[model samples]
Target: MTATIEQPTKVRRPRATLQLLRITLVLHALLIVAQPIAAGYFLAGNVDAMTDIHATIGGSVWIVAFLQTIVAACYTIAGHGRLWPTITSAALVIAEFVQLTFGYAQNFAVHVPLGTAIVTAVVWMTVWSFRSTARLSRREAKR
Candidate 1:
């Protein structure tokens, strides 16, 4: 006579998702805060020039930066299961490109470089993440 073997329930699935979200959290938050952070970096190089630019562009840059970072956070956390992250991430990408266009026209040299880099990185990451999310949603829907 042979005994039957049974499998145990798994716990790593959701944890993996959370882990992925945490990466987005760390990277997004750090880059989002780069407005003030980069100002400090630039200050060491040219305090007077950076100070003037920070005073003028700081508010708008920080607002968009933080908001988009939040959106990225949302994307990583619940994006694979819902539709909002997809919409918000799409909007995040579009809004950022628009900002980039306007900012470049205004003079990329004078304004903060970190803002441009952050926005660009967010746009690309958001787009890629959204594609993954769309695939997952489709798979889920079919099931």
Candidate 2:
């Protein structure tokens, strides 16, 4: 009689939605960072150019935040991401809208601090999303 040896199968990790989330999150973070820099330029006396640039970038951040929320939702529903990322993303979008309103109303007292908080939150999410591994489903692990 001969003894047989068994080899374990290798499984591939599927990270499509996760990758999408990371990419969008990073892009959103970049946009969030750019807003303050543009505002600084405007405050530095480049009002005409920097003001337009700041407004454009500020609007762009909202669109990116909305997309990030959607991507996070997909990631969570697909069983890859946790609930917190989705929750945070939704909250970030709402906060961003409030920040936008504050800016339009010339409420710097609220806008400045809220902008700082938004940037901090987005940066944290981007770093966490990229560094952490998603919870893999059994079906995914077997593949």
Candidate 1 ranges with C-alpha deviation above 4 Å:
1-13, 39-80, 107-143
Candidate 2 vs. true structure, TM-score: 0.81
lDDT of 1 by residue, 96-133 (tens): 45555655466656344646555566546545553543
Off by over 4 Å in 2: 1-14, 134-143
TM-score of each prediction: 0.38, 0.81
Best by lDDT: 2
Poorest lDDT segment (10 consecutive residues) of candidate 1: 9-18
Model 2: per-residue lDDT, tens digit, 1-143?
A: 99998887654443787889889988998889888888988888898745588778776787788999899888777745566788899999899999888888889999999999999999998887766355453345345
